[model samples]
Target: MTLSEDRVGMDPITFCDASMNLTYLGVKVSPWLGVNISEVGSHLEQVLRRVGELRLKPFQKLTLINKFLIPHFVHQLVISIPSRALLRKLDTSIRAWVKEYLHLPASTSNGILYATNRDGGLGVPVLEDLVGRVALRAGVKYLLSEDPAIRAMATHSVLQGKLEKLADSLGVKWPCSLTDLKRVRKQQKSNILRAWAAQKVQGATVDIFKGDSVGNSFLRQPSLLKPTRFKTALQFRTDTAATRASLRRAKIVKPGEDTCRKCGETQETLGHVLNKCRSMHERIIKRHDDIVKILSSESLRQDQLTTEEAMLGLTGENLKPDLIVLSQEAVFVVDVTVCYEHKGFVGMARQNKIARYTELQRQLKSRFNVTHGEVIPVVIGSRGAMPAETIKGLKKIRLASKGLLKTLSLSALRGSLELYHSFMDR
Candidate 1:
C-alpha cells in the first residue's frame, strides 16, 4: 500500500527507501529521508536478491517487521497480501506518475515479481521476498553449532570427505556453505570447515541405515548383519600392532606349542604346526590312512613310516608346498583347529576367508592330481571350542593357506599311507 502519506513504521515493508523509512506506524529511520521514493526502488531489489540467497521464505518476515522498519508498520496491517485486483487498481493509479518520474525497465511489463512502471504498474519494492533468505542463512549457521548427532559423522574423515564430494556433485558449489553456512567467510585456519560440517550434517537426517548386501557374508558370534563384518580383518596391517597381532594370533598351530613334534630340533613355527605337530591329530591321521588303503589298490607304494622321516619336507622355508599338493591323488589338506579360540570373528568374515582358502585348495587339486577331499577346519584349543563356517558357499574347512598341506581328518586313519602306497605301487 504505497500511499505517499502511508509509508512508515516496520513491517516486512511493501517497500522502503528515499523518503520511505517509517510508514503510518510510529518509527523513524533513514538517511535518504525526504528523497523521492522512486529513487530507492532499484536498491531494494538488490537487497531482495541477498534475501533469496539466504533461502528464507516470505512469511517469516512477520517477526522482524516492526523491529527493523517502523514501530507499528505491520502491527495494524493484515498478514495476507493484497489480492491481484486490488494491486491492479493501485498500479493503474501510479502507472503514469511512475512512468514519467522513474526510468522503469520495459522487460518486466507484466510481472509483479518485478514490473515496468511504463506498462501501467507501480514499480513498488518487493520486501517480503527478501527477508526470508536472510533468515535462512542465519538459521543454517545456528543449526550447525547447536546440534550434536550431526557431529558424530562430521568428525569422521572418510564420511565427511565423501559428503564433500557428494555436495559438489549436487552443484552446491562451496561444500562447507551448504553443510555449514558459517564457513562462508573462511575465517579460521585449522579445520573449521570440518567442525562446522557437524552443524551442516546435523541439519540433514537419514531415515534408514544398513542395506541389503550388508554384513551378510561374515561369521560373527550371534551374527549381527552390519556391513563391517570383517571388522577384525580390516584391522590387519603391514606392520605394527594390528597386523603383527593378527599374524601371531590367526593360527592353525597352537599359540605356545614348542618344538616340531616330528623332529625335536626344528623349532615350531606356524609352518611346523601344519606339517610336523605330533600331538595335533594322532587319531585323525590313523583313520585317514586306513580309509585310503581301502579306497584304492595303490596303497603299498605309499610310505608307511615314522613321524620324523615322513614329515621331513613338511616344515621350514624349503618345505612349502605349492597349491598342487592338496590335489595330489592321495594327499590330505590339514589345518590344526586354532582359528576358533583366538577371536569371535564374524561368520561373514569367515566365509570370505574360507572362500579364499577354497581357491587355494582348488589350485592344489589341479596341480597334485590327487583325489580331492574337504578342507578340515579343526579347533585345537584347550577350551574345546569348535567354530564352523555355517554359510552355504563356505561350509567346509581350508586345510592350506599360502601353502602348507597337512592330513585331512578323514585321511589320517590307520593304513591310510598303506592305501596311498598301494595305489602308487600299481
Candidate 2:
C-alpha cells in the first residue's frame, strides 16, 4: 500500500530499525543488559578517577560523596532498578576509595562509613540502600498517581510484584492504596535502612562505640577548623584512630609493646593515653585548663568570678573549685573534668564534681548574698563526647554552648591526639 493511502485519515507514523541497545531520555536501555547499569558504572569510574586526583581532605571527600556522587547515581537509580549484588559491588568500590582517601584501615566497619554523622558514622549513604529508597519513592509515585491510566498501568506492571514484596517487608499492608504506600516509602523505609546500618556496627564483635552524645556537634560549629585536626578527631571518636591499642587489635604491634610506652602503667588504649597515663598528666592538665580558660573567660564577662581560690571554714576544710561565678541573683560553682568516654565515666565525673562542690555551693550562696546557688560540672569525654550535664552547665552560665562545646571537644580531641603521638614516640 502507498504511504499516503495508508496514512490518509490518521497521523503519519515512522519506524526505525530495531537494535540491541537504545538510549532514551539520557538512559541506556537494553533487553539483555537492562537499564544503564554498565553506563552508570563507567560514569562512576570516570568521576571517581577525577575526584581522586584532587587533594581533598576526608570530610571534603565525604561531602563530595554525599552531595555529588550519590546524587549522580540516584538519578539512574530512580529510573532503573539495579541488582543488589551490582549495587553492593559499587558500594564496596566507593567505600574502598573512601578508605584510601581518608587513610582509614581496611577493617573499618562499613556501617561507620555509611551511617549518618549524627549517629556517629561518617554519613555516607550506602549505594544499595540509596537505590532501594529511590526505587521505593518512584514506585509509590507511580502506584499512587491520580491519573487513572498511569495508576492502572502501574497496578498491572511487572514491578507490582516487586513493589508488593517490598511493601510487605517494610510492614505496609498488602492490597494497599496510594496513601498507605506513600507514607511507608517516604518515612519508615529510610529509617529502617538507617537502623539496619547502625545495627551492623552495633552487632559487630569489635569496634563498638556509641554515637557521640552531642551528635558530633564540632562539625557543625567551627571548632576543629583544620582538616587534619578534624580528621584526627573523627578517627579518635570512631575508634579507628591508630592508637597503640588499635594497632594491637589490628595485630600491627607486638602484644607486649601494646603497654603504654610513656608510662608503662597500662595497656595503651585511647582512654588510657587521654585520661590515665601518668606521663600525660601535664598535657592532660593543660587540656583541662584550656576548657576551664574558655569557661573562665565567659564567667569573667558576668558579675563576679573566681578560679581555684580556696574557700576557708566549713569545719576547717578548704575547698577550691575550678570556677565560681557570683551574680546578683545566683552563685554558680563550676568544675571542669575530662574523662574517658567509655563506661559512663563522663556522667560519673559530672556527679562527682557536683557533689564535691555541694558544700561550696552553700558557702558561696551565703557569702555572696545570692538567693540561689548551683554546682555546675563541665564534663567532657576525652574523645570529645559531651554529656547533657555539660550543656546544661554552659547554659546556666549564659554561655553560647555551641561554640564552647566545639572548643571543648576540639581541645579534648587534640590533647588526646597529642598524647597518642607522644606515647607512640617514646
Candidate 3:
C-alpha cells in the first residue's frame, strides 16, 4: 500500500502528476490557481511567542510590533502579492495581538490604533494597506528598471501596457524615471492628506507645507531629548495616549467614570483635566506658570525682552504670554498651557491657544509697533506629555533650552499627579 492510499482521512493525492503544487520561498504555487495562498501561520506564531514571554510597556509593545511583526508580513507580500482576504486575516490577527499586548479594550478603534504616532495614534501600520503599498512599489520599481534586458521582458508582459497607461494617466512625463514616479506618488499622498484634513476639520486651513521655525527645530533636533520624552511629546501633540480621556475613549474606563474623580462635576476629559477642573486648577496653573517663568528668564538673558516685559504683559497687548522675545529681526508672542496627555485634548489645547491669540498677535503687532513676529504656542502634558511643537515654539522665540523644557515639563507632570491623587483620595 503506497503512502497515497494509506493517507487515512486526507484528500487523495494524485501520484506523478506534473501539475502538482509546489512550495517556493514560503509561497504555494499550483498550475491551476497560479499562486495558491501561502500559510502565514508561522509568521504570526513567532510574534505571539515573543509577546507571551515578555511583559512590555504599551509604547514598547508598539515598537515590537513595528520592528518585528510588520516586517515579517511585509517581506512576504513584497515577494508575492497575497489575496486581500489573506491580507485582512493577517491584519486582524496583528491588530488583535496589539490590543491584547497593550491591554486595551476590544472596542478600541482601528483609526486610533493604526494612526501614525505623530497624529495621536499607536502608529501601527495596517497590514492590508501595507501589502497593497508594497505591491505597488514592487510593480513600479520593476516597470521602471533601467536594465535593457529587464525593460524588454517587462514590455513584452501583459501588465506592461496597462502599467504604462496608468503611468501616463498619472502624468508621468516622457522618459520618466523611477524617481519621478515616486515624487508624483508622494505629491498625491500630500494632496490626499490636505483634502482629508480639510474635510474632517471644519474651517481647518490645511497648511502642512507651511514652514514654521518652531516645528522645524523640534523635528530637526530630536537627539536633544530622551527617546521616551520625544515619544511622549509627539503623543501629546497628536493627542493619542497616557491620558484619562484617551483611555476612556478606548473603552478602558467606564463611561460614567469618565468624569474627574476628584471634582466629580466635570467630565474627566483632557481639556477638563488640563484647563478646567478646579480640583487640579492650582497645579495646572503652576505648571504653565513655571514653564513661562523659565522661558521669560531665558528671553531676558538673550536681551529679547526688558525684564521679561513681554511675558508679564507689561510691554504689549494686555496679553500675558508665558514668555515673549523681541529680537532685532522679529517679535515672538509666546503662551503656555499644560494640557492633558490625551491626543484629542492636546490638539484642542494647542488649537484653542492659537485661536485665542491669533487676533492677539495682530493686536500686539499693531499696538506695540513691532513687526516680523510669530505666535509661539507651547503646550505640555502634566505627566511629561510635552508637545514637540512646544519646544520648537520656545526655540523659535529664543526662550527655553531643550533641557530646561524637559525638566520643567516633567516636574510639572509629577506635581500635577500628586495633586490629582491627593484630591481623589481626600
Best by lDDT: 2
Whichever of 1 and 3 has more lDDT, that candidate is 3
How many residue pairs of model 2 clash at the backbone? 0
Q: In angstroms, give how far residue 313 of model 3 lies from its true place.
A: 8.9
Model 3, position 50, has a per-residue lDDT of: 80
Model 1 ranges with Cα > 4 A deviation: 1-218, 221-265, 283-426
For residues 15-78, write the lDDT of model 2, one tens digit per residue. 2233455667667676565675676776887777778778866667767877888887777766
TM-score of each: 0.17, 0.83, 0.59
Top TM-score prediction, candidate number: 2
lDDT of 1 at 360: 46
Local distance difference test scores for all models:
0.29, 0.69, 0.58
Assess the local accuracy of residue 326 in candidate 1 as a C-alpha lDDT between 0 and 100.
Answer: 24
- Deviation of model 1 at 257, angstroms: 11
For candidate 2, give the lDDT of residue 394.
77
Task: Estimate the TM-score for candidate 3.
Answer: 0.59
lDDT of each residue in 1-426, candidate 3, tens digit only: 123664546866543344566666656567565555455656576666687568765556667778776786687665555556777787788778776665554544454455443333445666665665545555656657898776675566554544454455456643356577577656654444454344332112123312222322333344434444544444433344355666676677867777676677866654565557887767666767776677766667777763234322324545555555567756666777776454266678888878666665675577567767677778765645556677667667655665666566556555555554445455
Off by over 4 Å in 3: 1-37, 146-259, 300-335, 339-396, 400-426
